[model samples]
Target: MKVFYYLKHIGLALLPHSWFTRRQRKLEQKFADQQDYIQRRVDYYLKTAQPFTLAPEETTAIADYTRRGFTSYFYDLKEYLHYFPKQCRFAYYFGDETHIEPRHTLFKARPIAGDNERSVIFKLDKRRHFRFVEDTLSFAEKKPMAVFRGAVTQPHRIRFMETLFGHPLVDAGQSNPSETHPEWQQPFMSVEDQLQYKFLFALEGNDVASNLKWAMSSNSLVFTPKMVFETWFMEGTLQAGVHYVEVKDDFSDVEEKINYYLAHPEKAQQIIDNAHAYLAPYQNPDLEDLVCIKVLERYFSLSGQLEK
Candidate 1:
């Protein structure tokens, strides 16, 4: 899959300008029936006032790579920008952009709810963030214990592992080796291994949880506290006890939530179905392209760059 990702990048980078425009035109026609949804997405992601030009010094010219090393963020972000005008100006702060001030447009994988105006999120870190799995095992076949396996990046996660490390109903742990906290470390588990559990933790780390997308797409039920950050996946829209089972901030109810769902398999299945439905829009690549195009168009227009 990594090889495929790089190859796709190489192909896009080499592809001529006309090909991208035609692809967008093709997508527009192909999904013409879904204009309302496409516009809604574009508006949701971009809600800033129009006709405001950012200073040239504050903006960046469109290009292939923002810096020397090309990561997945560049790949995803450039996919939306390269086809646009070369003179187009924009500001971009890559990586976990927590709070972006006004007129300071930043493109990142995760944007907190309050910063949505200029955050301009796309699926930037595609290699790690966009993972989908096909689970053949039913909820009945999976273990009853809820499971979490990820890097202990946040202090909140450390507290989670400390509180429930020995709990039998939960099999949660920090999967990465940490010299500072060897006790919190456990051998890394693949997403496939996590599918074995009935409940999967979509705990937030530095940004939105990378596992949330793939975990919600799986057969297992997802457990998460309220999400403060969002991406193209629209994490903020996810409902507690509907799309996923909500966990308290203190995480005092992990076992209780897991146990309640275990006793009522039907209710768990409904939430799983709702999660799949919520993810339905993401299944269409054309829709994503259309939304990306509109987002950039609105961005440039609002930046008062249409005259260029």
Candidate 2:
């Protein structure tokens, strides 16, 4: 993503540089046109006539969930996970003592060097024990700055989802909602792909959330499609199963995960099956994309994007 942006910028930068030299700036123009086309497509997606932001039932359910500090975790996750980067010009996340600490503090975290130190800490609310490691000049320069130590265990991961979501993650090998219409059929879009992108986008919005968190096996590593469904769904609701899982905050890692999944034959088959089961609910072709889009609209509204 950053490379795309840089290429787009460098291409334009060449225009000014070329003006002084007067050679054919054809390549620069091509890059500029490409960038513009990409931007236009994104704008179209955003501006398309979306379904209502949320159904009345959905709004009521979400409001009730929030009072308990639990909303539709998947929906919120999807919004914060995906839509942000495509929308915001300068989007980044920061983790610091203030947001990570038990309570808010005046010592806020900033991007650049200051009193802020790179560190990793785990807070177990039940035990009230904060386990952490301090940062040094050496560690900060590496590719991924370490934060939380010890991989989040599977049980703990489930517990975390339950805590934030008010329920367990969806289960695997469960039945999908029965299709209603005779014309309904599975669409081409991949549900797992949509989920990965959405999750990545959400991670991008949080300041404490690292770009490496997904690749490092924190949230991304732990949440496989099978595991995600198993954790979220009920006993029999998820009919088929989960397909591929990819969670990477970094742009390069994102592309790598996509490629890795694509290349793995066995994994790809499972992913396809899982996505089909998930798509069973929206048997109507028109409603398949609507499912994701409507969820996102609800998310943005909850996050105050729809407010006048």
Candidate 3:
């Protein structure tokens, strides 16, 4: 399995852009029938399910992009929403991001699905369980520096790395087309290995970093920049000092933040504990289902669909 994974990665790296475009087109064509079926299923589920009791002002129309890349999180959300009870009052507007535009609605919790884009799907329960090196380690025992491993996709990431390249407080390196070494040459770090560190850097890539959830799950304090994007978990809902330390997007204050946290170990641990507590409600799969139901209820109430 490892060999096949590497071979595919290498092939993708060597393949031309046109090859991926053609592959994407083929994927859209192949999933067209399944997409149509899912859409119909969604309609049936919403129209026939038990009615929810909501206030008059709660009913509103929600717009979701119907035509999305097969791998998009929005596609998964569409599938999940099907399991919800039929909400006759809730109305759906199906269109792409370009047409619908993401408002401060339930849909904003999901990543924007687009053509040839890499995105993180918000599924806390479906992650790979990693075997830790040991049961526990003290804050002093773990590496004092923050660790970050990901591809250099955006210019902001590149600039951040360049500034902190040789900083003692940071053990940052690239995993995809690795900056420390060649692509697919170095062994990937397991989640357990990352948990061994005192601090974890959750930087944005093509979209939000998938590692952010795992970081929050761990005992280590998470440091991330103010995100322009959000997932179903809503990073915006988390407070900077309470849940995770917020770093400047330009990364000018990363070093300062790290130094302060290291000096005040108690404060850092408090934030880590708070983050875990904040995420506890979302740890269950049932909460996601409830969120979908509530979102629909609100949409229906706001749109005056119940009056119909």
Candidate 4:
């Protein structure tokens, strides 16, 4: 069965990574052009509204680099083609920055079937220059939503499932050790869930000094988002205590930032003010600011600031 399914979907499965193909190149060009267009539009807007002087090259670079990240999602979706009875739907979305490491599983599902529905969800974490996964959920037309309770993020977990079901692999979701194994009772939380924010916020506020220290220690691990909208400003590093706060060059840490700002409006304002000036020279300042602001708003809502 696995062999049969592999043979069936191999063609579409072999689509090249987004960076190498002609159509992607064309899409990349389109994105580049759009950035240029937006920058000019923004320049016009800013020029009329405020007295600002920006380097053309800086604006172009900012626009070009940021657009590349934002457009990749659109390009990926645009390039998606139906493999007949195997239409691919996003079950989880992750930017290329997120490494889709292999995991072993005990439950098996057909990959062809998965292409149609089973998917994982991840958001691009610009601050970390990677995608921090929110959650991995399974899809079935009739079902509400099912959690993929596996033991870990590994290929063996998926393979275990494949063997269990005797079917070719398609896709998977996150697993909970407590549910899967009796000896292990680890609490599982999806990044998509609201609790993650609360937890992180507590971690940050609970021991500001320690948290800052830890953040600094792990500064090198952070990756800024490739997009202009991200707030991961590449500002080097800050030493708050024994540990330093890993300063991002951009603002991709949208969620954390909103929370931080809400909690410490002064600091947040400082960031917003600085970003306004620092990113002024880069491309599409308005659009980039808009994205970051929107992300902040969403976080506000999630934090119960807005009524749904």
Candidate 2: regions farther than 4 A off: 1-28, 32-37, 44-243, 246-265, 268-308
When 1 and 2 are scored with TM-score, the better candidate is: 1
**Candidates' C-alpha lDDT:** 0.80, 0.27, 0.55, 0.28
lDDT of 1 by residue, 227-291 (tens): 87887787777898889998888899888888899999999999999998988788777787788
Tell me each candidate's TM-score.
0.93, 0.19, 0.60, 0.20
Between candidates 2 and 3, which one is better according to TM-score? 3
- The TM-score measured for candidate 1 stands at 0.93
lDDT of 4 by residue, 1-308 (tens): 44653454455456654422354345435456466644443332212221222233222221122223444343222222221112111122334322222221001111211121111221223223222221222111112111123344344333433332221211223344435444333345443442122112101111011121122222111112221111132222222211121223332343353344345534533432343343343334334433232232232233233332
Residue 160 of model 3: what lDDT? 68
Off by over 4 Å in 4: 1-34, 37-174, 178-196, 199-308
Estimate the lDDT of model 3. 0.55
- Give the best candidate by TM-score: 1
Highest lDDT among the candidates is held by which one? 1
Order the candidates by TM-score, highest first.
Answer: 1, 3, 4, 2
User: For residues 208-307, what per-residue lDDT tens digits would candidate 3 score against the true structure?
Assistant: 6667777887778888887755554565467889999999888889888988988999999899779778776556544444444334433454434533
For model 2, how does the per-residue alpha-carbon lDDT over 158-209 read when each residue is reduced to its tens digit?
A: 2323232221222211112223321222233222322232122212111222
